[model samples]
Target: MERESSALLFIREKSVGFTARVALHEYKRQCDGGYPAKLKKVLIVTAPLWFKAPFRILRLFVREKLRERVHTVSAPQLGAHVPRASLPTQLGGQLAPDHAAWLEHCRNCYTNNLQNNKLDGVIDEYVISNYIPPVKTQNGVIEHEVARDMTSDRVARLEQPDAMHISDPPYTCDTGPLRHTHGYNGDMKGGHIHSGDEDEVDLITRGTWSSGEASPGLSDEECAGGGAGESAGALLARLRSLGRRGLVAEYEEIRARPPQGTFHHAKLPSNLSKNRYTDVLCYDHSRVLLSQIDPEDPTTDYINANYVDGYKQKNAFICTQGPLPKTYSDFWRMVWEQGCLAVVMTTRAVERGRVKCGQYWPAAAGARAVHPPFALLTEAVDVEDDYIISHLVLTDLRSEMSRRVWHGQYVRWPDYGVPGGGRAQPVLRFLQLVRRAQRTALADLGDAWAGHSRGPPIVVHCSAGIGRTGTFITLDVCTSRLSAEGVADVRGTVERVRAQRAHSIQMPDQYVFCHLALLEYAVMHGYLESADLNGFDDDNEDESE
Candidate 1:
């Protein structure tokens, strides 16, 4: 078998230092102190901070410790070209002051250590290291995910497999993106293209994990080459059968209407408080724009402003073309300047020139000036990919779609300015926060629904605050209030939502997007149709596009 080898070395002669970060990577109890005969390939690195060692003796000891004894590097040695087996550090003053800190990160393992009988400042210490293994093990991350595709089995095998392992969910989450994003080409960037009701993008959603599952960072070629064991083509083909019916059931019209009933209309939880938001507009949810605004609507002006700097943010507004437009930029400016978030259409906001805000950015402000507190910038990835969503499901399923706006996550790109579109909202900073906070929220919501409800007269919004937001709200409410009622027509749900709010996503792409959103919600919770609700695997397959 042909194998490839790579190595990393770090050593600095100037301000030179040597440190060993040791961990029991593969431990067995056959006389614990014995050498690891099986560890044929090992990576060794030297730190940058200077420390004198009786290295002449210790160097020999380190060499003796290895079986194959492949990689070796020494700090403070330079002007030398050594074989692949060796690496030398540059001379003094060559390393960055933070090089040692960066080295600690290289080890990839974190721990607290006990130290005594040292200098006064030296005590027990917590340590972190980023040890890049010469070869990484399987724990793959998704590159790009769209509704029209699938993945490989070598892609599976989680530490402890569950629903999370079965499928990769979306990246949207409070804990930031639950999955790492690798490759994307803007297919889902502008917006989802409507594939027609009877036609859906074709692809596989699940795969079996045998041995040799791909690691998290392998390039696409490396992943494909990593044979994950062999399976029958028949089985693979069966899994690939295109499920033509909309992934989201078509509940074209409301089944039993709202029943004019006293639903969770009162039962929804008002768990959050007004004081919770010192600056209400500091973190704008994406649902707001997707549901409420339009370029033409005249009433979209937000009369309040509540945020940081807004005037110089370069955010363009759309409406009646007065002081503020009905655009999100205009409304968001108001949100940044004042505490007001108005319910209006995008066109109207644009026409107004400035969506009324209690506060406004200084005229000479930068985008960062009006930046929301919890907003984020991230590596973009399509949310519909199973691998991405499966990873999210493995992590925090509830937050997969709730946090960001109009499907686009706020991501940080330094020199590259943000891409613009009606549904777009800046949120990369918030994605980072979501990566950590979402899990707790999911645990709290239980399995009934993914998002925390407003309890009384709750509001759900996308960029327009109508289509995607309305659909999600409808599903969430029905799941919580009418789970017993068999799956209703999605179209019916949309119509009902429209009755409450006019012009709920007239765009075709937006319509398709609404269904996909529903699929994401249903699949994550193991509740796919009322029939499947009663503890049935229904592993039975075969769907056509």
Candidate 2:
């Protein structure tokens, strides 16, 4: 038997749609060199019949006639194919279970290979190894040749007859600009060129990264007027030059590394134990210290939250999960202690027939609530199409100090999913409001936002702080980077956020959505050519990875 020509997938009880897709993706991606010869007879042995459904969707994503070769059989049926001496006893054969040991050995071998840099050689063998010269730029704008090199070839390949008939892998997040195929009808240049609202545009300025020391081979001429100073056309062109798979691979590499110190104490209770309300905890180093709030009790010092720094901005946000009913007071106390000027709430109080978040704030204007040591007064409320803005006045009863906070609740973004590309206006509009509010508050502090101490972190929360919260923060930070530095690194931004808060951008789809959302934001703000923003379908968004 030619082992390279055949493959077997043994599906156990824990196999889900994500697992099946991952297996298929690995097989397809790894066997790309001679895929036609490989996997000619892929067989799946399972205990139940329902496991076959995931493979049906696999065809739509993998673009291969995998269903034709995929065969799912029960344990009783496995005996007919394998010799009685070779099969496991559970499958009515004499062999005992040894697959687990073999898998462990394979893992060790792969680890050794990776440490020896053999993995890179393997990848090099599979790839065409196009000579990507060190990119050169002029006046902060990428040279047309560089942009052409980055996009034209990929688009041309995608336009080939064989490629046009194929579909993307299942559960893939479509970051409009980074995908291999050209989604727009040939005319990439045709789109809305101007912004509808000039007042909402962000201030773009040259950033620290513009210095040659930070970016080697980039002279002042190459980065002049770069960052926020670059024109929208140049920025969009630069953004379109990135490889989607390369970005995904970098993100995966970051996830594979173990954290240096998990800060187990930062967790509300023991790390081993968890409840439905707070299953995850922030690491100690990145966690917000509230020891000053209640110096007497150490328990009061802890909250299920972490401080996430933004691009060129420290303590940009205090990311946390939805406040549990009991921790509502702690949540508010953190906001008050941290001097947060705005709260970016991405999830609704309830979602999909489940209590996703606590109704921590007052429902209507003029309503007042006393959550102990702090009293929250809802001064006013303004409801918009995609979100609600509330004027909240929080008074710290202990110090008799009162502060007004803007509560921006984005209602449309679903839990564990992303806001569709077509419906980006509301989210972008809401984000602008938040940024403006933060800027005004920072300005009032005079140098605090920029100098010795940074401005108060914006308190952002969702059902789980890591998913939608991470997505929102990533978009905000990347946009800010684009405005100040004229460039954005999606993978780097996500890695920074994750360093502060564990598991930021929870799944692969969320990670990809971050890119898509940024692209949508660019179009809305006239930074990118605006095509039919609604042409992209984010309806089936999944956090499979």
Candidate 3:
């Protein structure tokens, strides 16, 4: 081998599968045992996000002098390191090598050398028989020069005899049943409330109260008459009657009740720094505990998140605080351990010049951000009018396995109040997009997800993980109920969520916004006529100050 030669490696995305990752890891181990003094420099281009972290970890095991020679760069940045004249046209260079001619010359030289030495007995017959010269096509293209499409037989022969055996089961990339017992205080209904049948009662009847009649609030008389039934129109009429004052009063009533469960884990001095707010704590009974990275250290399993039930499914959502700088690793660990498939972010990273949440993900497509053992790669991003959807792949460096996660961030929602200046259309539309994505991902899981009524818990977070987070969860649950049973229980849904996550619906306005969001959903889905909301004022002008 030439001592002063440099190597340039181009990695295509399709070639970086699980088997390739394992093989690369074994190669790294050999290199670390004995650093290659012959190679001067190695430049790797278009490497997958999963390969970057393990490479960095490999540097720690290699000699310091050899570490500085290896470099990883994007295609556009290659010019800064290497001259364009020495590169191939495919890699933004001026020269392209004639691979066919090079192979033919090599074969001729080998034949002459063999004839002069008479070394037929010294060389292996299998190696000599397999050496075939490159062939040219009708269009003058080298047919087998690159070996891009190698046959399985050739690959099997090339594989090392003592390859590492993987003992852990292969990751199906599908969510299984819940591993831990959920702490939901509500009744266990055993299955999903919505059957997804088109013939189900998705639309609400006009009921006894017409659009022209005065709104009948949820008074003692109405509760006894038709309010007790699961009628969507009756619920809407009661919600309209509440108006601003009644809604605020209803929120106050929920606050007055003493919170259930204790906060022993959250109050510990070691875990205090993990929480965004000192008072907004997760209930110990329902808190989601991380699988301890260090078995000896108990604090390694702490994260400010909880498992909250949705409609009829247990542990349907994992509500958590926005990840802090130190807790990014823990956030992803919880995501991986819990088998979560979706993440819904309701607040921006920065609001009013303050950092409300840390930027835990990559900033753009084809970029990656590492949080120690977990590396997140943004495969693609779709920007919409009110939100952004990211297609992400999360890789575990230790296991060399990966899973896909769908991330939806609603940017228009302000830190203090709802989006669209208290309007509900934007929020409802965003919810629709999220649900559609979730359904598609679940279906991709096939039989693993098909065995259960609901997929794994969807991770949700905002600034405090209560205000906007709670509101979004409430909206999801209430909308599903209304669609299945034609009834929206705004107050009951908020109470149920707060039972698991303390201080959920942080502000009274958020509590009222849930009702407004549900009403809009009812009208938009044809459950109620547009004229039904004629006398109702959906604005939050009188929201609590």
Top of the candidates by TM-score: 3
Writing each residue's lDDT as its tens digit, candidate 1 over 1-545 gives 00111111222232333343221122112113332212223323343323223322233343333312222323211111111112221221111233454344332222212122222332212110111111100112122221211122222322223212211222111111111221110112112211111212121211111101111122112212111212222212222342213322233323233221111101112211111122111111011111113334311322211111001110111111112222325433332221111221111212135432221222111222223222222223333211111011111122322222111122221111111231211222222233233334334443222111211012122333433334333333333222233233344434533432333433434444333433434444445431122211122233221
lDDT of each: 0.24, 0.54, 0.61
Which portions of model 2 miss their true places by more than 4 Å? 1-253, 268-278, 292-296, 421-423, 442-454, 530-545
What ranges in model 3 sit over 4 Å off? 1-230, 531-545
Two-way TM-score contest, 1 vs 2, winner: 2
TM-score, per-candidate, Cα-based = 0.22, 0.52, 0.57
Which candidate number would show the highest lDDT if scored against the true structure? Answer: 3
Model 2 lDDT on a 0 to 1 scale: 0.54
- Per-residue lDDT for 101-194 in model 3, tens only? 6566555545654765644554322122333322221112233333211124543643444321111111111111110011111111221111
Worst 10 residues of 3 by lDDT: 206-215
* Model 1, C-alpha of 256: deviation from truth (Å): 19
lDDT score, candidate 3, position 244: 65
